[model samples]
Structure formats: C-alpha cells, structure tokens
Target chain A: MADASSTAKYEALHNGIEPPSFKLPLIDNPEIVTANTLKLVEQTPDARKRFLFTTLTRYLHDFIKETKPTTEEWHGTLKFLSRAGQLSTPDRQEMELILDIFGAEALIDTINNPPKDSVTERALLGPFFTEHTHDVSNGDSIASEGKGEYMYVDGRVVDTEGKPIANAVVDAWEADDTGHYDLQYDNGVPDCRGRLRTDAEGKFNFRAIVPIAYPLLSDGPLGELLLAMNRHNMRPSHLHIIVDAPGYEKLVTQFYPSEDKWIDSDSVLGVKKSLVVDLEQVNDVESAKALGFQHPERGFKLFKRDIVMRRKVDA
Target chain B: MADASSTAKYEALHNGIEPPSFKLPLIDNPEIVTANTLKLVEQTPDARKRFLFTTLTRYLHDFIKETKPTTEEWHGTLKFLSRAGQLSTPDRQEMELILDIFGAEALIDTINNPPKDSVTERALLGPFFTEHTHDVSNGDSIASEGKGEYMYVDGRVVDTEGKPIANAVVDAWEADDTGHYDLQYDNGVPDCRGRLRTDAEGKFNFRAIVPIAYPLLSDGPLGELLLAMNRHNMRPSHLHIIVDAPGYEKLVTQFYPSEDKWIDSDSVLGVKKSLVVDLEQVNDVESAKALGFQHPERGFKLFKRDIVMRRKVDA
Candidate 1:
C-alpha cells in the first residue's frame, strides 16, 4: 500500500508536476575549508601541536584542491607513480632524489629536525649520502692514486661557541673527475670518497681531486619536465660532507666551487656561501714537504676551514 | 678533451677551496594552482560556446579535487565506472540516467536544444524513454498495459506568452509506482511509456499510473560512497517530458512533486521550485465524465503546469 502511494507520487511528478528544490546550509564566508580544517584539528587529543598539524594538513589540502585532474589524468598519474616504485634499487636510490625534487624531503626534514634556536641553521640530507665508507689517514689521499689535481681539505669541527670538538667525525664523499661515483665504477674500485674521524685537537684533513660540475640523471620524466621548462639539470662543482660529534649536532652539507657556471643553477638548490673557501697554491718545496707532496715542480693546493655544529640539549 | 680540461679545472678549484658553500635559496611565497571553469575558456580556441563545456570540465575537476582520494580509493572509482558502463543497454538506456545523475543530461539538453521563447517547457530524455511508443487517445490510459498506481495526468502545453502551443510534440515517460520502469520488468512490455502530441488548441492530456520516489541502483561503488556518507540513494518524485515543435523552441525539463521529501536532499541537486506543482486531488462524476474516467468513486488528481520556452534567435 505504501509502495502504491509512492508510485502515484512518482507518476504525478514524472508526468508533469515539478519537483521542489532546497539549498545547502552553508555560511557566506571566504574561508570555508580553513574553518573545516580547524574543526578537524580540534578532534585530535594534543592541544599544543594542533595548530601546527592543522597548518600542514590545510596546506596539503589547498595544494591538492587547486591542481584538480580528471579521471583520465589520474590514470596517467598512477602510471607515473608505479614507475617511481619500479626505479628504486639498492645501487641507485632515485626515490630519495625524487622526494628531494618534489620538496617533500625538505618538508619532512623541517618537521623531523628543527633548528635548535633562531640563530642555528638547519640542513638537508642530500641524495648522494651513503651509510658506510672506508676510513683513510689524515694526510693520505682519498682520491684514486694520481687521478686529478691534489686537494688538501683541512677542517676543525667546533661547537656553536667556537670551542674545538675533539674527536669529531667528518665523513666526506665526492665524484671522480669523470663525474662517476666509486660504486658506479665497473672496475670494483671505490671512488675518491672516505670517512675521516677528527684528531685529538678536533682537526680533520683529506687529500682528493676536486669534483667537476655534472648534470643530474636526465633521462626520466622529471628530466623531461625540466627540459620543457628550459632549465639546466646540473649541480655545480661540489664535495659532499657530514660532520658529527657526541656533544654537537650532525651537519650534512656540501662545498661548491666558486667559479662553476652551474652554481647559480644547481638543480637540487644546495649551495652556501659560508662553506666556500680558497685553496692557495703551494709552489715552494718546504711547504710541499709539510703537506707531504713529493715533487717540488708538481704544484699542490692548501685549504683550511672549520665545521661548526649546533649543540643539542640531550647531546 | 674538453671534458678532461673541465674536470681538471674543477679539481684545481676543489683543491683551492677551504670548505665551499653558499646561502641556500629559500622556496618562499609558494603559489597554489587555482583552476576552474575559466581555465578551459582561456586554453580553448573556441571560447564563444565554452560555457557548457567548461561547466562539464569544472564539474569533473571539482569532484576529483573535493574528494582527494588516496591511491587505494581509485579502485572503487574504477569499479563504479565499470558498473556505469555495464548498466547501459540498446533498448534500456540506463546510461542516460547515469548522465542525468551526473547533471550531464540536463547540460546537454540545455546546450543542444533550448526551449522556445513562447512555447511550452520540455523535460530531460530519461533512461526509461524509448523511441517507439504508441500514441493514445484523449481518454486512453497507459496504466492499462503496465502495473502501477491508477493515475490521470492532464495538462496543456502552453507558450511562455500565455498562449496555447497547438499540436506540440510532448514525449512522456515515468517509472512504475515501484520506481521501476517497464524495461526493468522481466516480460518484454514497452507500452508503460508513450508520446502524445498537443491538440490544435494547445491542449494535451495523458493517463498513466504515478511513479514512486525510489532509490536509484545503489549496488555500485558510488552507492558505497553514498552509504558511507549516511545518505539515502533515492531521488524525489518527478516526471520527464520533452516538448518539441518547429516554430517554437524545444524545452526538456522535469516536473517534481511539491510534497517530495527527497527534494531537500536530492542526490544530483536537480530539483527546482519552478518545476514543482501541487497535484490537486479531485473526485466527481462530472469530472470523471469530462476526463473519461471509468471509476468516478475511485477519484482522480489534476496536475496543471505551463512550460515557458525561450524564442530561437533570443535564446
């Protein structure tokens, strides 16, 4: 009987009579979604962190809200995402680089590790960082024997107060002259890279050839996107380094050559002025012997700087 | 040789640098993408009639943007789309209803064929609307052949200028009281719906059982989403009509029952106040005689509505 009455109503409406309409109960405000996000944040238990979480969540929401793609475009996106997964391997860690390129790496890094104070500077862990490396002597060359120009990088690790941190660890790595890593070498020789723990006076030094500016991997879809934008895909001449100590913070940073053309256009955007220093030429025999150079005619270079790290509370 | 020299130059720089670094560029003042219907107008060459096209494009984009589904949510979307395609058939056109639910049907009707400035209004071509239908006489009943409520829908097709549109083609269709169309019936009976052209004085009348406000097919992924949202999948009671004439403009619109509860929460946001009517009930021997009703004691209802179609050139 109920069904029959409903049937009659449908007939009355479908045959000719019009249906009624109503409007949604929404406020006349500009920030509708922001208000909603704030409401959602209130659902969380932690009151102190609610504002930060809401900010991040709302930012992400706004990011996706604008770049709305169709179902077909979504299919293309999924295909691209699957390829990202397929490209990840032990030898070539492209996933980390992808995260860096998309700014997710920076975002996560900012949240996971903030600066100790307003004066301290936070750093990023770049893609080329590896877990382990062969430790070399202070004066011994870390480069392939007789490969390129001899570089003497001497540095002392210090606290924020400028006091030398005895036994600080400065692990460094750099590509060979051909822009190839030690692992990428087919001949089973590790490239010019090593880990050298600072001495008793917080002093650390290594001898290696400087690395030339090289283009990032430019065969992927990201590379195509860069090419379309007419942007160069090269990082300027640089050396990767990580300084660590018990009482101070670990600083993951890079040193870029001042004259490299690609310095202004480093694709990964990793360059700092404080990290730049000149390696003065040494033609004198006495000076060469002090730095352990055999041939007096064979010119060598001397570089000296200090690594400063922020001191953490617990450390 | 060029590569080798460049490599040497980099080495010389590396040997010369103390600890190379520079100020990192900040990614401040980030811009969020804001695309809407206007984007299509800007990108497309044919900007004159971009209204409907951009509406459709923005509709899809907004749906995807508002529902920021994770990768896992896409599977449900794919399944729902697959079922939408599966629901389509040659004789039974469920695809049209799917389009109606998506507002595509009304959009196409509004764009392709507009109502005349002085003629009667038309409704959308619904899923139950089959091409082949036997035109009945003034007193003929469509419910005599189908199973539904005993209803008599009588109305005249009039112009927007308060004049009767004589001999206008009025195509009509509606589901049974159970909200099921004739095609949903197991037996192959197509007489449940029919077409009746308005008479010379712009008077048109037809007899059919009332259709119930029924829930749409809710077994698919869209259904699941509806259920998750705690929303019923039913639409308000409504009728479909298509008024087409040579001198007058074509109008396609739905007539909705004024008392329909679902009007407040229409799934597709289709119901409009201008389309609703009271659908008055009446019971008299004289009325039965004039309308050719067999059972005067059973009573009948009157639904009167005038469709206003826009003129050709002005529209």
Candidate 2:
C-alpha cells in the first residue's frame, strides 16, 4: 500500500497541483546506471528514432566510462558543446562543422547513401546549400562579376542506362577567386550558385569563375580544434552539384580541379578520383568562339562531367 | 607553379588579410575524415586533455559510423543536446541530469574511484550538497519544526580497525516528507539537513523527518526521455551522508529504508543491498522519554549505521 504522504501527493497531483521538479538522485553505480538508462528508452514508436537514441545513449555512456572525465573536464566539454549549439543558426550550421571535425558527416553519408554499381560516388552536400536557389537557363553566368580564371561548365543528367533525363534539376555552386562562397561575403546571395533545368537533350550549362582552395573557419571553436589537432583546414577547389530528376535518386557531389595540390589531402575529404576533373584550356579562336567566349586569347577553363543518377528505391 | 589566384589567396592569409569565417566543408569520406580529425587535437600541453580529446574524437566518429542518422534525426538530437546545455544554471544543472539519464555519472564514478577491500562504497555527492552545513550537537534535532514522520538517527564513524575516531565530521541530508529537498522548497535553508561532529566515542546523532521517495524531473528533455522509455522516475527513500576524519578517506554513501518498494528501482541507481536498513519504531512512552521525545507512545522511527573509512593513502 502507498504511504499516507504518497496518497496525499497523488491527490495533489490529480487536483492540478504541480510541485517543483528537481534532478534525479545520483545512482553512484555505473553498472546499474547503464542498465537503468537503457531501460529508459522504450515507448518511442518510431523505429528509426528509437534505434538512433538507443545507439547514441550507449555510445555516450561508454565514452564517459572510457574517459572518466573529472568534474572540471566534464564541465569543459559541456561548455564547448553549449557554445557549439548557441553558435548555430538556420544559415550558420556550426554544429555541422563540429560534426565534420569529428568526422561524423562522412561516416553518416557512407552509411546512409552509399554509391551503387556504375553510379557516381556521392559527396557531402555541405551546409552552404541554400534552399530554392535562383533558377536559371542553360549557359547563364551565375557569376556576379568578372573574376579569376573564367570557368565554363556544361553537363548532362542521365539515368544509369545512359538515357537522357530531361526536365532534371541541376544545381551548382562554387567559391569565388578569393576562396569564399557568396554567402561568406557581404554580397548576400550566392553569386556563383544557381539552379538550371536540363534542356530537351538533358544538357545544362553554367559559367562562373573557377574556385580557389581555402581553409576552414580560422576564428571559431572548430578552428581552435584544428589548431589543437595540428591539421591544416584547407579544402581543394571544387564545384558542388546536386541533380534531382523524376524516378531517379537525388545525386549530391562535388568535382575538384585536378591541378589543385590540396585535391589529394582535401581537408573535408570531399573528393573521389572519379569526381576530380582535368579542365582543358583552349586559346584557339575557333574553340573559344564555339563556347561563346569574348576573348579567345584568355581561354577559359572548361569543366565537364555527365551526371549518371540511379533509380530511387523505396525505403 | 601555383595559379595567380592561389598565390593571391595564400598571400592574403599570410599578410593577415583574413576573410570572414564560416563552417568547414564536409569531408565526404569517412577514412580521411577520421585521419584528418585525429590530427586536430594539438597545442594542448596537458597530457590528460590530449588523451581525452583524442579518445572522444574517435568515439564520436565511430558512433556516427555505427549509427548513420538521417539529417532530420541528427538535427533533432543536436537540438535536444543544445536545449540541455542552454537550460543549465548555477541552481539547475540540466547537463548533469542528462549525464545521469545517460548513465555516464555512474560509470565515471566506478572507473575513477574503485571500491577498496575494506573502504565504504562511494556514492556521488550530488549537487544538492551545501558546503558548511549548520553544525549540530549530539541528540539535537536537525529538523526545525514538525514535518513528516519523526526520525532519529545515530551513527559512529571509524577506520577499518573499528576503533572509535573522535572529531569525525558527519554530514547528512534527506528529502522532506513530500519528497522535496529544502532546496526544492521555497521555505529557504534545508532545515532538515545539517552536519555534526562525532564525540570522543565516535558517536553522532541527528533528529529529522523521515525522507520520502521521489521521482526525477519529469518536465524537461530528460523527463520526456523517461516518458519515452515508459519508466517510472521514482527514487527510493534514503538519507545521504558523508563522513570525513583526519588520516582517513572520506566516505560518501546513502541508506535506503527497507520499507520502500522503490528501493530496488531507485531512479538514480544509487541503492545497494548493503545500504538498505530497517528502522525500528519505539512506541513505548519510557523509550520516547529516554530519547527526549515530545510524544509518549507515538515514538519516532530510529535509524542507525556505522561508517567505516579507510586510511588515506594520499592527499
């Protein structure tokens, strides 16, 4: 039987009286703690979510056990995590960068969206992709102004069987000559990023400045972590692309210029040998004119890649 | 030769013309991501800190690989963690609660402070402990006024030899009759909790209200988590104690009243079979008068325990 006090407490609860809430008592025993904590994850109906929490809960307990952090160290970690969360915004995904530094993004991508046979290797879509990018027609210059080595890119979206997929959405973005994305600058909109619909032949084209390799954030906690790690934060120059079409898998990838030295040690590990393109330069007047170039002598670097998407399977 | 733009970017970085900072790029490959991330924990002169970060980084990546959460799920987890951190205050230690729910606290305690052959088993001191509790004399009422069932506790603290150790400090605290600590109530100082000095015979006494079993917080993320787990948040009724003396290890522990059904299911996992004790009710008027009781025949419950401390090996 419940004690008289317990009965009174229940009555108070039923009568709309909520007492102040406090933290649970310390179990002080690790074995029971893990067992009891694992028992706390049951009623969630969503299988995927439940699985995620269970795994995460296990990992967290194990990490703590292995580390055995002192109270000071524990507080330090909590502070760092707190700063990471507080620093995040809709546009600024600092937490994602934290995951990158932890190498979580790459692992998750490999696990959830692995490449299939004869399919192009996928890369991280990254935090910079803005939803509803400005729509454009083929051959439109996504660049806001003349800068660096002129880059000309034309690609096609096709099924794995090589059949042209018209009406496909081809989205592309890259950094400017200064090794910065449009969002990183005061210019606001990503001048070198846009979307285009594939033509009747499944072809899409975008003209912009070739991107320059650059380092990651150098003034934040992530940067501090990199400094602590003694690792260079540089990434190779590349163009990011995403192609979505009816009945096909949404492809997210990036293509690095082969000549960039950082390509081999791309900080974010975003490169696959198949995704690296060897750009061709043509100073010949005829070749430049065919590409609608205003100056043949100042030949632009041509980057070409045909995206082959796989059929989407129902989850 | 480096491209002119590449040269310019390098020059800008070297010349302190640092551009704006943003999140790092996604590495895309788990192997390289892990390698690159492992290379990030440097500049820390503290060896323990270096070890901590290196292990944490590995575990984080491994956990992600083992559980490839979808973007939405990952974000949801991040948000939950963020909220936990944001909700923490000097008084409200939500992060600690999160740790408790995850079972980290128990594991850490076990790993860092192992049980010696003859020393008392340790329990977490918990955040509710107030430094410099009001000192009480033997047979004094630690309770300020009538609350719940009257409780009388007397204990002795000694080394493994079982010899009386004079001048030992015995600190004690317990929940009120309603399962609320003085800190949880608006009545101010924990009139139910205090510390006392052992007399020449290593004996101490404190009179207070019997502690009531209570539940963990059921209002925040941890509470929601408990709900999801479908587990009752109740903790068994117990009294927390700490005994310290010169040349002996401090002993921190709790004693659960055997009558409480939740003893085996203490939410904090703090209850051990050895820590359970039965309280005796003395209903005789003469016995009540002998113990300075205000009521005859309606005697209070009496609790008794002897604390065994080990010789301190080091400072």
User: Best candidate, TM-score-wise?
Assistant: 2
Tens-place lDDT per residue, model 1, A251-307, is 777776665665544554444444455667767777666776545467676666777
lDDT of 2 by residue, A132-230 (tens): 467878877777656568888978888888888999988888877777676565434557789889988899887777888877665556666655554
Off by over 4 Å in 2: A1-75, A131-135, A186-190, A218-221, A246-249, A264-268, A281-298, A311-315, B1-72, B131-133, B244-253, B272-274, B293-297, B310-315
All models, RMSD in angstroms: 12.8, 6.8
> What DockQ does each candidate score versus the true complex, computed on alpha carbons?
0.06, 0.28
What fraction of the reference interface contacts is present in each model, in order? 0.00, 0.31
For model 2, give the RMSD to the true fold. Answer: 6.8
lDDT of 2 at A31: 70
- TM-score of predicted structure 2: 0.79
Tens digit of lDDT per residue, candidate 2, span B106-208? 5666667666665677766766787746788888877766667888897787778888889998889987777766666543555678888999999988787
Model 1, which residues run further than 4 Å from truth?
A1-122, A293-298, B1-315
TM-scores of the models, in the order given: 0.47, 0.79
lDDT of 1 by residue, B194-246 (tens): 77777877777777766568676555443543443334567777777788877
Clashes of each: 45, 11
Output the worst ten-in-a-row residue range by lDDT, candidate 2 chain B.
Answer: B11-20
Query: Candidate 2 falls in which docking quality class?
Result: acceptable
